[model samples]
Target: MMTGGLSETKSATPEIQDMVDEVKPQFEKKSNEKYDTFEAIEYKTQVVAGIIYYVKVHLGGDQYVHLKILKPLPHTGEPVELLDYQTGKTKDDEVTYF
Candidate 1:
């Protein structure tokens, strides 16, 4: 089974860095800062070396490990406050769960 695993990374030390650098300027010039760069996106994964890297870009959504950008999933349609049920903790408890 393909459990939900999606990690983003930005490493240009070998070559991707160079490519990102080259591409970012053009992208920024075209998009006019509507979105951040891959570097700004905070890449949290790693890519290997000695193999042709296959990068898949998503316009407004994201990508999965299998290089598939699944269609937009439906929202829960429930108010977040409805889910904030704590027995004793108050809303001002100074803790925010992700």
Candidate 2:
């Protein structure tokens, strides 16, 4: 699974960096616009039995991405899951572009 990135606390990680790299294009496509750059601001994780259940990333421009790491014990693979994408900049932050 995509097992690295956000920390239990508010900090950045290489895993999250990788996630950002992979998800950026999707975000742009979903938003129907392009961002010259993206800066992840904050993130929180939900864990169960010492394993991460999911991650929510707060990016610059008030964009947000929700990810969940899938499990199956692949011999060699990065297991990353994308649950949803959202643009919190809209009125009331209730709208999801994708």
For each candidate in the order shown, give its overall lDDT on alpha carbons: 0.29, 0.48
Scored against the true structure, residue 58 in model 1 reaches a CA lDDT of: 27
- In order, what is each prediction's RMSD in angstroms? 16.6, 6.9
Best-fitting candidate, scored by lDDT: 2
lDDT of 1 by residue, 59-92 (tens): 3334211111122223644211111111222212
TM-score of 1: 0.26
Which clashing pairs does model 2 show?
1-79, 2-79, 4-15, 5-16
What's the TM-score of each model vs. the native? 0.26, 0.49
lDDT of 1: 0.29
Stretches of candidate 1 exceeding 4 Å from the true structure: 1-13, 34-37, 40-98
Q: Cα lDDT for residue 1, model 2?
A: 29
Tell me the lDDT of model 1 at 37: 26
Compared with the true structure, what per-residue lDDT tens digits does model 2 show for residues 1-98? 23443334445477666766566676667668776645443345543333342334555454655434333235546445454554444212322112
